[model samples]
Target: MKITQTRDIRAANRWEIMHQVLEHSPISRVEICRRTGLNKATVSTIVKEWIDKGLLAETELGKSGGGRKPILLQPLHQAGAAVALEIDISQVQAILTDLSGERVLAREQFPTLGESFPQVYHKVCQALDKLLAEMPPSPYGLVGIGVAVHGVVDLSGMIRFIPRLGWRNIDLRSLLEERYHVPVSLDNDGNLAALAQQNLEQASLGPEGQGSEALPQSLAVVNVGDSISTGLITNGEVFRGFHGFANAIGHHTINLDEPVQCSCGKYGCWEQYCSNGAVIAYANTVLPQPISTLEELITLIRHQDPLARQVMDRFLTYLAVGLTNIIFIFDCQAIAISSELLSALPYYLPEVMRKMVLPITHVEKVVLSRLGKSGAILGAASQAVFQFFQDTAHAMEPGQ
Candidate 1:
């Protein structure tokens, strides 16, 4: 039977309060109420419930100026864990984390490319087994699992397509749920990365951080590797389009006259000009020697090799063009670039900024992702943690 889910306003409020406590621990109920705009009674009720559930704990008493010493609330580390797994181009990785997204254990294994889905699936299972075995005792044991797929995922938790991985129409969610017996969250890598980026930003801009009040509520996270894809986070949540493909900028046409074909069966797509693979491919076309890695190309550029400089100039120009288009379309508060190329952003950002349509403002919104490659994995685990907190039964369960 299909079960349609609806939100519980109380639960959402509880989540908000719980997140505030997690981010700013040792916080008083009055402060929580003030920050969340929740009534004192409501905050107290939720805090009591969390404490009863062993998900929150009361720390030392507050300062003496208060009438009665107010007890501070903090997230309980042993509440439960969330597992995150990712199926990338050549690897399967699993990570286990507690309620606050702190890593407890991790496992990774390389699955031979071009292998059958089942073979790759088996490899993922092995990594998960190892991760689970290494987890410590906790009240909530593996409450949720989040899977990150390197492709498009549908609402039904099916991997619809992944040309790079040769995966199509695979029911990965069902396969894992049947074996692991936990709520599973599935999303594309780019979307997960965006979530992680947002989480990172929030953490860094906590209540104590200077200018925390001025942080943006929306962002555009771009991943530029084998393919250029983007993920949009607006109003503190992901913005999935009708087809759950809002950020397929890689397939956007940037050069109509170009002859090269993209994996998406399109000519002169944005990725063809801006992706790391595209850079190497373009380098191969101009340089007599093939540039196998970005590091090699960067090294050549550092030495001012005429051929390397020419290829890099073109790559940067194309990257600037693509980024310019993104700025015009999203107009988001920030555009964070996520890739190994992030290290090089310092060198090329000025050029990219100069090419943008908008005038440079005092706000430095364009930057690099702090989480880097780990963003996707962290985001996956965070999704599971989100589900865990949202589950009324699980979140309210008292300690056994």
Candidate 2:
């Protein structure tokens, strides 16, 4: 028991040291010790171990504070890589990123609308094959693959259901892992988007303010695409509730009089009124000509068409209603709306705020998501890199 405890502690220390280096490289051993509160000996020993393991590299000397110029350290980013995939109802997009989650290759994608699981699977595999072939040479090669699916994903990575695609009980993780021979993480698109947004917020803090305490302890991300879903971050962690379905706020009923039913078998759900599809559908009903896409609706609104303006006004009203409910329930530090249409219109936010019956403080908390459509994609890649470090840490023992 004592031996095992010692090993666990050692592994934890290694993880901490490595995390600090990855976040603030090229950082010095002395700076790491100062920031992490780890002793000089522990930091130096772990740094040496990682350097010897080919995961870390010592770079040029940093600026001198006083006596001696300290040698800076950086992660060997090319030592490993991760693949991130975003499985949308209409398409599948994939990107290759380094150990630091930096893009290593151009984005690859293929359409998957109305395709069967087998067809989608084959296309995904082909895309992966092309990506792998073009991957730069590395020591660890592909460390893991992270997938973002729009649906209810369980703790074990089982996709319980995807309402948009009619996919149910798919073990995508196991299938991908079996074929690729690497770790596969499957998560809800909203959850992954929230994760990516949180990381971006943390990174914006810079080195001195990069820790969790410096950022909001609770935040929420509302993803508005074909449908509406939400991701919550509580105490600086993704809040996947007991059943891994905590933040499915799209299904939350916001209207009782509406006749339209949601995919989840409910009337007047939030998504039915506030999603991009909802906006376009409503626009088509009110406009002279039918509009099939959000882009068309946006163009009409840009031209100051009276019907388009009316549709957007109603959309904003419903959007504010749902957002107000979210704020009342979660009381997050900030609520980020991830939508192409919403982000494109700078005036929509103020309009939404005007419609919401909330205090000035609450109104200030609402803002647009900086990540846009790439949130889930980048989140998947970051998750893979995170898992790799975690596994690497736990695998460390007394010696090789």
Candidate 3:
């Protein structure tokens, strides 16, 4: 809980004090002093300002000896609200959470529109409108919208590239700004998923994972749906390399000698062999039947069909090889597989774990994400939450 002042204080250090209280609330002035190293007088000044601003409230008195009550303080849950949005070619998911990443409200999902970018953007705005109509009116408007896309993106809302959606050089941020008239943060979905895992498991991660040993300094989140790839976190920060192009493990050539066309304009990429599409293709090759969704394939695998088992086995093998490289390269604390894919892994992770050790002996704990399919949106929202709490000095500007 200890927080060091990272920058020059402004606005009476309002955001910093509010952030610390939000993180370690129901805490006394003494504890706040100890955690933040801010003098008792300065802490008093900030706490009073927050209380007056309707941003924090005093709870029970403290028990620092039999003295006058040192009132406990916590953030006002309604001081502000943030919107998180997930988008792709197929569907868009949204959630509104408070500063603590807790959903104080409901979630919304809607089908994506036609091929036109403007159409899909309108659909998203409509979805937000619908969700907002259902909420109880409050003074705090939406803090900002955090958008998660499927391509490379800078902090600006530009869609640098997304082949599935055929979006390139699209000014998505500016478009959203025109709609919401508020700040907008944009990032790729994979990184958002990684943020979701970190936020959802914060109590169980960092230097404090559930087990005896401390959490690893690195993590890799792999989403196995229409696409196969990874998002990496190291030392508690997303690692986007020189050009914001990192952790595209799906394009890693797993089948180097066996050439096949890949979605990323490559040959023999791993996604061609390990994605859900690959699983469906393998099943169709053996069973000669059409399959519509990945969920159906899971049902077949659960039933122990030979074709399902055969495809799953190969899929797990290739997945482990790529994940093994991730393990070796980053030596992460844990690997989080999406919940949609974990069910099949229950029937296969034992074998995957066994094979993962085929190349390396030190086994990192591999776990299934607890957030389900909503992870990307939740993750994107968490980015907003963190951004909202961070001191201004650390806050990267809209286009930075």
Candidate 4:
């Protein structure tokens, strides 16, 4: 009867819905229908399948409808729990997020400097224990942990070099695995930032949304801090050039001023013009007194210090000159900014766009990251999960 026909339509609709839900769960069937343009009967059928498969659980019971109650669906932690760890020179931050990237608990932050590798590792374990104590048990359990830090980490988890952290060739992956007894993933901080933004919003960079799909996918993740770099994502992956030397735009030779030396043993790398270090350097020259941080400059700007104003304008101009080539080359639909710099995007974003040679319509596409540091941790976590999934997918064959 009508029930059988409803099921058929719903079955097909559910498949479509699940694909979308895999990326964005915790949504109501109503939103799913609007997103996929399907009827309620179809949504219900698919939701039931997801519910039966244990991939979803009921989060809320809405008011009684025309017949039955409305239930809000959330993706179960089927893909399992993931631990995201960011190792900074000054602090370490960790978070545990479900498959859908919803942080299930409060993040744990710890000091990083002067601690032995074993000591720092154990503190992370203790933090995980504290977070899991209040949660209900799940089926998939903890699948993996992702760690991101400054430096070169080979696929093997060896930290080749981290100048800021003052570490060289440390065996980080093996050490973490020994303690956590879970799969560990390590990536550069910039790469993780790009992954975080990708999950938050689809880039209009490609043809399906903004331009031609035939073009190679691309990303520019500008992170401003004590250390800075842009992580490039291309063709649905991080474009680590032969030997992983891509996206080091921070050292692209953007300046030639004297007494300006980059850590890479060069004069006027892009970092000298667009990084926090650059701002601080300029603030000292312009103002009667040197400013310690970007926050101090912001405050100075508010007080109408002519020095702050000039420095801000100069930063914007340099950033513009650096990114214009990005648009021409990557044809990037979005240029994501992360870390503490995101909060200041509203102030300097327009100026950054104005400096571009392109039209206002094109420049208006400058995209700021939706998630801040949260993206960094989650990006690492997602990397671990995807790596696991790929391995699993490869191991299973259709005939087998």
Best of the two (1, 4) by TM-score: 1
Off by over 4 Å in 1: 1-7, 61-70, 206-213, 359-364, 393-400
TM-scores for all predictions: 0.89, 0.93, 0.85, 0.73
> What is candidate 4's lDDT per residue for 1-400, written digit by digit as tens?
3535543444445555764555555567876787788888968876776677566677876555477776667667654677778876567888877755455555788887767666776887787776556434676667677887755665556776665555777877887788768788888777788877766555333312334433225667776665666677777677666766455566777666657567666787776777776678878989898778888888887787887888888887877877886666566756777636436546777777778787543532566677765666778977766554434333332232
Error of 4 at 13 (Å): 17
Q: Each candidate: what lDDT?
A: 0.78, 0.85, 0.70, 0.67
Top candidate (lDDT): 2
Candidate 1 positional error at 25, Å: 2.8
**TM-score between candidate 4 and the true structure:** 0.73
Residue runs of model 3 more than 4 Å from their true location after superposition: 1-7, 10-17, 24-26, 61-70, 155-157, 205-213, 344-347, 357-363, 390-400
Q: lDDT at 301 for candidate 3?
A: 78
Backbone clash pairs for candidate 2 read: none
Candidate 2 residue-wise lDDT, 1-400, digit = tens: 3535777888888998998887678889988888889999999999998898899999999989699899999999889889999898789998988888856575689998788888999999999988898888999999999999877888777888777778889999999999999999899989999999888887676656655546777888988887777899999788888989876788899989978778777898988888777787777789999988888888988999888889988988988899888888887778889877787786888898889887644733778888898888888998898888878887766563
Better of 2 and 3 by TM-score: 2
Off by over 4 Å in 2: 1-4, 210-214, 359-364
The reply for model 4, stretches above 4 Å from the true place, is 1-19, 26-53, 57-74, 113-136, 155-157, 203-217, 339-342, 357-364, 385-400
Local lDDT at 183 for model 1: 90
